[model samples]
Target chain A: MITLNIIGSGNVAQHLISVFQQTENVVLQQIFARKREAVSHLVADAEIVTNFNDLKPANVTIISVTDGAIAEVSNALPYENQLVVHTSGSMGFETLSNKNRKGVFYPLQTFSKAKAVNFKEIPICLETEKEEDFALLERLAQSISDKVFKIGAAQRQSLHVAAVFSCNFVNHLYQLGHEICEEHNVPFDILFPLIDETADKIKTLSPKEAQTGPAIRHDQKTIEKHLAFLDDENKKAIYRLLTQSIQKNNG
Target chain B: MITLNIIGSGNVAQHLISVFQQTENVVLQQIFARKREAVSHLVADAEIVTNFNDLKPANVTIISVTDGAIAEVSNALPYENQLVVHTSGSMGFETLSNKNRKGVFYPLQTFSKAKAVNFKEIPICLETEKEEDFALLERLAQSISDKVFKIGAAQRQSLHVAAVFSCNFVNHLYQLGHEICEEHNVPFDILFPLIDETADKIKTLSPKEAQTGPAIRHDQKTIEKHLAFLDDENKKAIYRLLTQSIQKNNG
Candidate 1:
């Protein structure tokens, strides 16, 4: 059985704790939080520790903390030459202190406190500095997820940027759409099926091939009509910019 | 039974034909395509017609042609004062010739010929010039879809613009993400779970509340790093613009 100790009390940390607890082949050694009470409800009181010095030695230590705090927290780990990793998509694997065998166990999914996520489908991007540590990291990642990608720090960084475009920026576009619907006094639910279908189309067809609309067709009349309808300057600018990008990319 | 006739042989027309054939309360009277061969495979040869004069009388004659062709098609339909509707999101209800009772039956989902879509969940936006025609249109819409909205021409036009932002623009962002993953030699599947989660989150939370990532946090460091990682000038510009937009929207 792979023994794991998770550090931090954020959404990612809590999710990891819950998944690891239920995983048959894994033993959750302990959970570390700045305040033990933060994670006390997730595990036994004995398994919660406030001080880094009190962290138990385990087969793997996952530091699922904030991106900025990853370095500081990894550096503060009392033990050295142990398998230590952080769950960050943007941060480089080297950000973890050299005292421990550095690795990355980034689960590429958004975690919300209210949502119960099934870890089995989440893709865990794993990286390790040492070749020997690769097996352990892969094994640990496979224990929870069906997909485990052996990506380097550089690739992971690029993947994070791609994610920002696909997830964060796309969600922003949805926000803009939501605002437009609200202005017209139309229920936002009308857009949900379209949103879902747009996402689903890419699974079988490449996004470029799946693309459709006035922009790709270069229907200038409709484009002008849409632009005239938008009252918000920022949204108008965004619509124009993206419409141009789509035309250029597809044309 | 509600009798229906479909015009055009495009993705929307074909999908509507398939769904109407399966609907218990609906009787698909005929399908009109300039080239009968294009849609003959979908319905009985007797139900396919090349000339508008051959179109049979029906409760509704849906002109599911291109937005540009709606006026001409409806004007060409030999029948007058019949319920003739166009399946376009952006086109105003008046686009249909005044010779016929104008209405709109826009299905608000992306339809691809290669993909078999389940119409039950797709939202059908219905609009009509005559208030009395609403019940008939609603009955036709309800025969195929579970969600039907009575949207006015103005609201439907705005909703179309909103759909451009959410569906067309959002799909372009996915294209960008796919390019990024390709450059990094990372399998795009890694982002699938994240994409699904991001889409799922907005179902329960407002897009404003569901937003995450460096821009939401105002983490300038990671944002700059991501911008630098994007080598393409257009992509760089998009990254910068969207980052600013997110910051402004959330700030």
Candidate 2:
């Protein structure tokens, strides 16, 4: 059995630990968190540690921490010979350099602590410096998921950038729509079907092929009318900018 | 088996035909289209009628024509006392006035012939002038989907407005992201996970709770940096608007 150790107790760590515990070959040897009280549930099952010195000897040490703390945590870890991995889409694998073996086990899915992750379905993105060691991470990933991808650091960075544009920014747009409905005494539930369908289409069609709206058709009349409906100055600004951007892409 | 007569051969009609066939009780009886070529598919399996006089006596008559022609098509229908319904989210049930029995069988979903709809999941909004007719319509809707709502014409209109903001507007944002990626020579495939995850989050988390980005953090520096990346006059305007909008919400 391959001994797996997880460091951190945030959303990613919790999700990762849950998946690791499920697998037959992969055993979660230990889990670490500074605030043990914060992760009381995790401490009960696994050999939980707050000190880096208390980390058990394991084949793999996966660090699931915030983006800013990645470098510091990589340096602070006691393990020198173990296969060290960080579950970050944005940060490079070299961020944990001088470590015997380093890699990335990024799951390209947005996770909330309260939400249970379906690791078997979510795509596991794997990357490593050494070609020979890639298979270990890849095999470990495939055990939990069928949608594992052998992505490089550069492609991963591009993925991160694209994610910000689509997930983070696109979500902000959903909030705007919700705000618009609330202001107009309209229930946001009306938009639920439309939003669900839009996402559903992308499974079969590309985002480019699935695109539709006034901006796509260059329907300036409707666009002008919609722009007039905006009461907030910033809302109007966003409406104008997005409208213009869509029109530019129309041709 | 309940006989279903469709009075249009547009996207909604085609989709309804495909779905109704899978359903246990409903049977697609006849399809009416203005053009013979348009009704070719319906003619293969079911009765096809071009003239209103050729309409068959069925349990239900669903008019799925363009919004502008809903009244005209309903007027031309040769039903004496059958359940007459138009599948429109915006148009009121009264559009089929003069007819003794009328209702709106508005499926709260965007229908494209290419996309297959899971009728059981999408909410079908129904409304009628007569209480009995409304109940019948609601029951019929329940046969197709559990997510049925007895929405008034005004509420339907409001829902359509929200749909525009959520579906149509959100799609425009996807295109904007695609354009930005294309301009940067980055493959748009990278954004798929993010887009999928963003939509999936709402299934569990509310838009307000699921929201995350530079805008929410009030990270003006990153927002300004991202804006600089998009040198287009209009793109800059959109960034500023969304940033301000998010900051306002967070505050």
Candidate 3:
């Protein structure tokens, strides 16, 4: 079994601990967090270390810290020549510079602390400075998920940008919709089937081919009518800009 | 079997025919289209009637024409006394004026002629003038779909607005991502898991609770960097507006 030491105690840390613990070929040896008390529950079976001196040696030291702290943490951490990794899609693998062997084990899925992550289903993106290290990281990822992509740091960054649009931005739009529904005193649940159907359509069709809207069709009349329904300038601006983009791009 | 006459051979009419045919107690008796050539393969069993005067008596007549022509078709149609139902969600049930038994069988889901609808799963938005007719329509709707909602035109307009944001607007945002990915030589399918995950998140958590990205965190550095990645000012404007909304709404 490969020994694992996870750093950071946010959603990614807790989720990584649970997944690693379940995998037959993996063992969670330690968990490091700035506040040891906050992450005690996460590292209950494993050793909990708050200081970089007691970072401990492991086959894999997975860092799941925030973007800004990645470089600082990597520079301070005392895992020399160990296989150091981070679960960040945007941050480069080279952030863990002290390690002779470095890589990424980024799961291309969002995590909420309370939500259970299906590690087997989530696609883990693997990247490393050395070929052997990359292969080792790939194997660890494949043990958990069938869909493991060997993506470069640049590609991962781009994919992360796309992810922001597809996941985060889309959720923001859902929030806007929920807001509109709340304002109108209409049940937000009414939109669930349609929302689900839209996602389902994209599986079989390209987003462009599956696209359905007054904006896509250039039905300015209906677009104007829908725009009239929005009281918020931000919502109106979104409607106008999206409508313009659909027209300009598709035309 | 309750015999039904479908007026108009447009998207809604064909979908309604397929749905009604699969239903236990409903049988399509006729298909009426303005042009003689409009009726095609699937409704071959149903007699095609071009002239409204040639329309035969049926338990129900579903006018699935465009919104602008709803009143025109309803007024010109010879079928009377039978439940006259129009399928436009935005149009009022009272538009089928001068007819004693008028109602609406507006399907909340967007329908395309090429797309086969699972009517059993789609929520049929039902409204009627008479109390007994509402029950009759509700029973008929329940026979084909478990999700039949009793919604007035105004409330449905609100739901339709919500649907625009959730389905149409969301799809447009996806199309933008696709365009950007294609331009950058990145496989757009890489964003599929993220898209599916975003939709799945809202199923379990509220959109506000599930919100992510630089905008929610007000990470202006990432937002500005993303904007710099795009060359188009219109897109930049959209990104700015949406980010502003995300920040404002979060507060």
Candidate 4:
């Protein structure tokens, strides 16, 4: 059985802890959190470690902390030459202290405190400094998830940026849509099916193939009408820029 | 039975014909298409009308042509004072010829020739020039869709703009994300679950509440890193503008 110790108590950390506890052949050996109460509801007091020095050696020590604190947490680990990984998409595993055998165990899925995602579907991205540590990380990843990839640091950074566009920026667009609906006294939920289908269409067709509406069509009349309809300058600018970008890319 | 005639053979027209054919208490009396081959695969030659003058009287005639052609098609209809509706989201029923009673039967979802959507879940936004024609249009809408709203012309225009942001712009973002993934040698499918969950999250939470990532947190470091990673000038500008917009709206 593979034993694991998780550090931090943020959304990612808590989610990892919960999934690990449920997955067979994996044991949550301990959890190191600065605030014990942050994870008290998730684990017993015996499994909680408030100090980094109190962390026990496990098959893998996951530093699921903030990006800024990942280096500090790795440095503070009392043990050396152990498997230390961070669950960060943007940052590389090199940020961890070199004293430990460093690797990355980033889960390529957004985690919210309220939503419990199916662990089996999440793509676990793994990176190791040494080839020897690859097997164990892959095994741990496979135990919880059906999809796993050994992506390098450079590729991971690119994937993270792509995600910012697809997930983060897409959500921002939804917010803008919501603002428009609210200002016009229309219910935002009316757009739910359209939004859902837009995301779904890409599953069967490429985004380019699935693309519709004025921007891609370059329907100047409808474009001008939409621009005139918008009252917010920021939204108007966004509409123009994205429209131009779509035309340029697809033109 | 409520007799229906659909004028046009485009994506929206074909989808409406298919759904209306399957819906109970509705008969597709005749379909007016300039090109018979466009819809002959779905319906028999006897049911198709190439000439607008050959159209028979039905309870309602749906003009599902392109936005530019809606007015022309409506004006060409041989009958007068019949219940006529167009399915263009941006344009109002006013675009229809004055000879017929005008109404809007816009299904607020994207349609592709290849993808068959669940019509029951699609929101059909209805508007009529006269209140007397409301019941027949409402009946037609409710026959195929569970979600129906009596949205006015002005409100429908706002919803159309909102849909551009939520659906069209959102899909363009997906295209950008796909480009990034292709350039990085990472399988774009790896980001599918994240995209699905992002869309799903907003169903329960407002878009503002469901927002995540660097821009929402104002993580300047990650934001800068992403901006620098984007080699395309247009993409970089988009990242900066969208980031600024998110911060401005939320802050």
Candidate 5:
């Protein structure tokens, strides 16, 4: 069985706390938050620690704070030479204080306070400074998730950027779609199935092979009609740029 | 029973034929293809008509040809004053020849030859010249899908553009994401769960509310790191533009 201590009470920390509490082979030893009230609803008061010195040794200590605060919190840890990790996609494990055995336990999924996620489906990306510590990290990751990958720091950075494109930029497009529908008095829910299918198609086919639209078809007439229909300059610019990109990629 | 004749053997037409064949209250009368070999595998020789003049009378003749050919195919129908509709998202019902009663039967989802989609989840946007014809169109749509909307011509145009943003543009972002992973030797499948969750989150939360990442957080450090990491000028430009757009929208 693996015992873990999670720092911070943000979205990622809260989510990991909830999942690890229910995981069969894992024991959440303590939750360290700046404010005890920040995590009072998630765990018993006895399990909450507001001081770094109060933290007990666990198999792993996860710093789930914001990226900017990761280094500071890792530096503030009172103990040394024990397993310490951070749940960050953009930052590498080297950012963690070298006083402790450095590692990364980043889960490659978005966590929102408004919705609870199933940990089993989330892919855990792991990295370790000492090769011997890799086994414990993998076991910890696999206890709650079926997918565990030993990704290096460089590849993780690229994956993070790729995620920003797929998740952040894609959601922005949905917002544009919603705005268009709202302006025309059409329901935005009408596009939900299309959005769902677009995501589902990539599971079986490559995005290049699954691409379908006027942009890929090079139907200039339809493209022109669509361009003239949009009044927003931002939306129009995006439409033109993305259309050219798609055509160029296909060409 | 609502009898329908489908013209063309494209992705849309073939998918419609497959679903309508299994529909209890609908009868697919005839399928017209320029090349008899195009639709020979889908229907029997007796049901395939190469000549439009040989098209017999049906309750509705669906001209599912290319957007440029809809008018010509509808004009070529031997019989006049029969209910005729074009399956187009961009074009209105007026695109069909005035010789026949006009209507639009547009499915607001991406149809691909590589993947088969569930018709029940697809939202069918219907529009007709005569108010009475709407009932028949709705019945035909309801026979397959549960989601139906009587969108006007202008509204349907906007919906089409919205679809382009939500489905087509969104899929392009996925392609870009896949390219980033491939360049870094990271298996692209690692992002599948994240993609699925991103799509699923918006079902309950608005896209604006569900947005997460460095762009939304206004993390200049991470953004700069990402921009510096990308070697491609196209991707770098996209990252800057989208990041700016997200910030502007949130601001």
Candidate 6:
């Protein structure tokens, strides 16, 4: 059985703790939080500890803390030459101190305290400093997820940036759309199917091929009408810029 | 049975024809194309007519052509005072000549020639100049879709603009993300789950409440890191602008 200890009481940490507890052939050794009470609800009180020095030795220790806290927390780990990893998409593997056999077990997904995500579908991006530690990381990742990629720091950083565009920026566009609907007193639910279909199209077709609208068709009249209709300067600027970008890319 | 004639053989017309043919109590009387062969395969040869003058009278004639062509085609319909509608989100009801009763039957979803969409889930936005025509239009719309909305010209136009933001512009962001992944030699499939989850979240949470990531958290370090990582000037500009927009919106 693969023994595991998780640090932090944030969304990622709590999610991992819940999944690992239910996973077969995996023993959740302990959970270490800055305050033991923070993670006490996630695990038995016996398995929750406040001090890093109280962390039990396990086959793998996942530091699922915030990006800024990852380095400081990793450096503070009392144990040495153990399989230690952090669940961060943007931070480099080197962020984990060399005092431990450094690795990464980043799950490429957004976690919410309210939403229950299926861990089996989430893609786990794995990296390891030592080749021997790679097998355990891969096995642990595969146990919880169907997809696992051996990604380095550079690729992970790029993936995270790309994610910012696809997830964060695209969501901002949804917010803009919602605002437009609200201004016009139209229900925002009307846009949900369209949003779902747009995302679904990218699965089968490249975003370039899936692109459609006045911009791609260069329907100047409609474009002008839409621009005249939008009152917000920020939205107008975004509309013009993205229209130009689409035309330029597809042109 | 409600008799219907469909004009134009583009993506929207083809999709409408497919759905209308399968709808109960709806008879697809004829399909008019500039070139009959363009839509002959969609329906029997007898139902496909190349000449606008040869179009038969029906309860309703749907001009499913491009935005610019809607007026021309609606004006050219041989029958007068018949219930004539165009399936365009952006076009106004007046686009149809006064010779016929005007209405709009816009399906508020993207239509692709290659992809077969489930028409039942698509929202059909309906508008009519004559209030009595509302029942027929709503009946036709409800026959093919579960969701139907009675929207006016201004509201429809606004909804179309909102759709451009939510669907078209969002797809462009996905394209940018795909490009970034290609540059990093990472398969774009890794971001699919995250993208789906982001879209799914807004269904329950408002886009503002659903927002997450560096920009929303005011993580300046990660934002700067991502901006520096992006090599394309256009992408970098979009990244910066959208980051600013998110902060401003959520702030």
Interface RMSD of 1: 0.9
Ranking by TM-score: 4, 5, 6, 1, 3, 2
lDDT of 1: 0.89
Instruction: Sort by DockQ, best first.
Output: 5, 4, 6, 1, 3, 2
Between candidates 2 and 5, name the one with more favorable TM-score. Answer: 5
**Per-residue alpha-carbon lDDT of candidate 6 for residues B1-251, written as tens digits (9 for 90 to 100):** 89999999888999988888888799999889888677777774338888889898999999998899988898888898899999988888987899999999999998888888998899999999999999999998999999998999999998999999999999999999999999989999899999999999898888888888899989898998898999899999899899999999999
Indicate whether candidate 3 or candidate 5 has the larger lDDT: 5
Q: In candidate 3, what are the lDDT values of residues B185-242, reduced to their tens digit?
A: 7787767777777888888899999887778767766677677777878767777888
Candidate 1 lDDT over A1-251, as tens digits, reads: 98888999988898898888888778888888888777778785238888899887788999998788989999988888899999988888788998999899998887776678889899888989899999999998998899888888899898899999999999999999999999889988789989999898899999998888889878888999999999989988898899999988888
What DockQ class does candidate 4 belong to? Answer: high
User: In model 4, how large is the Cα lDDT of residue A244?
Assistant: 98
Q: Write the per-residue lDDT of candidate 2 for residues A37-96, one digit (tens) a residue.
A: 756664435788899888867888888887667778878877686788899876678878
Q: lDDT per residue, candidate 4, B124-173, as tens digits? A: 99999999999999999999999999999889999999999999999999
Superposed Cα deviation of residue B237, candidate 2 (Å): 6.4
Docking class of 3: medium
Off by over 4 Å in 6: A35-37
Model 5: CA > 4 A from native: none
TM-score of 6: 0.96
User: DockQ score for model 2, please?
Assistant: 0.37
Please, what is the TM-score per model?
0.95, 0.78, 0.93, 0.97, 0.96, 0.96
B77-180: candidate 2 lDDT, tens digit per residue: 77778888888766677878476478888887766666777888888888877787776677678888978888887667656555665776677667667666
User: Each candidate: what lDDT?
Assistant: 0.89, 0.74, 0.79, 0.91, 0.91, 0.90
Question: Candidate 5 — number of clashing residue pairs?
Answer: 0
Chain B TM-scores per candidate, in order, are: 0.95, 0.89, 0.93, 0.96, 0.96, 0.96
Cα error, candidate 4, residue B92 (Å): 1.9
lDDT for position A182 in model 1:
92
Interface RMSD (Å), every candidate: 0.9, 2.9, 1.6, 0.8, 0.7, 0.8
lDDT per residue, candidate 5, A97-165, as tens digits? 988999999899988888989888999999999999999999999989999999989999999999999
The candidates' DockQ values read 0.80, 0.37, 0.64, 0.85, 0.87, 0.84
